[model samples]
Target: MSEVLPQFRLLQPGTAEEAIAAKLASPSARVCAGGTDLMVAMRRGLVETDTLIDLAGIEEMTAIEVNADGLHIGAGVNLRRIAGSSLIAKDCPAVAQAALTVAGPTHREVATVGGNLCLDTRCLYYNQSDSWRKANDFCLKYRGDTCHVAPTGNRCRAAYSGDLAPALMVHRAEIEIAGPDGRRRVALQDFYREDGADHLALDPTEIVTGVHVPPSDIASAYAKLRIRSAIDFPLAGVAVACEITAASAHRFSIAVTGTNSRPVLFEAPDPLTGDDDPDVFFAGLNKLVQKSVSPQRTTTTAAHHRRLSVAALASRLARKLSAA
Candidate 1:
């Protein structure tokens, strides 16, 4: 059965300040960037809102710029632009590659960076038709009391399946937020919490204005495991950023998504270089990633499969970057 959207007033804000004020003024208001994810959840009766604060018209949040500080990408910037941006690709290939993996090209055309960064967590038990959910007594992420994925746990087990957050986190990106008081910035990794029912660290009236990434000499790449080549969220994803370090030192970074409530970062192991045996190195890498990810039965795939795939992806990415 086709679901219907709740009645809501759309408030178009021309600036970040206006958007923050609009959200603060309406008690039942929710912010909308690209509306790619929010609208779908709203239609499914997962989100109840009377007003939507649209940030499409805000110029400051829709532009990309490069200065001495580094690359500044507005939150409203679409995934399509980010995927195809030469500057972004050259500066941080992981970000562009991650953006390209989001859904499909058409969805990317309209999906904004902010939307991806703040994507709602997903769980098979949580995402369902109203009738289907009612029959199951709903879920912990919504109206129900128990999380079907982890009934014994108090918090939700919905997975954060976004691909971009991990890639950005590897670059040490910072998030710019506009609120009722003023604008503030925080590290991108700090923007998310482990609780899936309430993932983003943003307040009700706060808006993610943009992201700032400093330039680095490291080379990086991104890859994800999905059921389909297009239009599907990742089952597990990996982003690897590595630099050519001194012969005695092995230094790099790895970030993962789709297996937990929030994107996770891991420090690369020392001595994980050409000197080590390929089989031995990969075995250690696999063990580390598998342990790092806590995959639940949140999707159709088995949790073990997702965990294995994450380890494989991490090993593959590290090998590719090291060779490059």
Candidate 2:
């Protein structure tokens, strides 16, 4: 990592409209909510920007409101607030739990919801220092022609390791975006694509303003497997949301991260009619994730290891939540 930080002109916008105007004025400028990820990438030489549009001064982006409809969280709200929110904790347990597990305490204090959602795809080969990447001939994500992870393929294999996306996916969330054209809402899952090099479908002029999760009564939980319990990104993360009543598992929506270019949301299977065997139910889930999750050699850990862990974490969370 470079010891010195890169210098850039920063633009502070007081409102979302102003922020959008600033971005329009500077097409190459990046919209920054919290600098947790952006600053690091800037210092690492992964990102080169002449201007940064900071959203910290936008008051509406920091607001978090819960009502009868559900939770409406602004993009700039810190993860710490979401992790400790009573409303979010009760109605959307998985969302709160995922927020609590992001990096460490200090990181959560500044990392914003928007930043996490729009996090850049990561890979061991691509996230190294400038000199290190140069010596290795850089990867397809940056300035190279071939992807180091899969030389034969044209697609970048970097993983989308964000924690909150999968959790929010299980709750059926929608993202609100503001751009040069106007404002629009899209399902959270639709906001991402399969390509790691350019996973988000956001236009250059667009800015994610907030996330809206409709009211839900399902019991949900999140669990992740990482090299370290804190500070490290997940090797594989799973979020399970189940609709259960009278102590029997009926329906489930499972989502996985860190194993794919974008978080994969598995479609819920046939409703368990209270007589389905636990072993059979879980076995099917394992097959579902293994068949759909195509984990490449992105991390130091073996590809198969992440695949198995993704299955295990999903099963564990499903079992626990199904019994809730």
Whole-model lDDT values for every prediction: 0.89, 0.89
TM for candidate 2 is 0.97
Instruction: Give lDDT for model 1.
Output: 0.89
Give the Cα error of residue 170 in candidate 2, in Å. Answer: 0.3
lDDT of 1 by residue, 271-311 (tens): 46667786787678878989888999999999999999889
lDDT of 2 by residue, 187-275 (tens): 99999999999999899889999999998787899988899897889888989899864655468888889989999997666655568
Candidate 1: which stretches are off by over 4 Å? 271-274
Candidate 1 RMSD computed on C-alpha atoms after optimal superposition onto the true structure: 1.4
Give the clashing pairs for model 2: none
TM-score of each: 0.97, 0.97
TM-score of 1: 0.97
What residue pairs clash in candidate 1, if any at all? none
lDDT of 1 at 282: 69
- 202 Cα displacement, candidate 1 (Å): 0.7
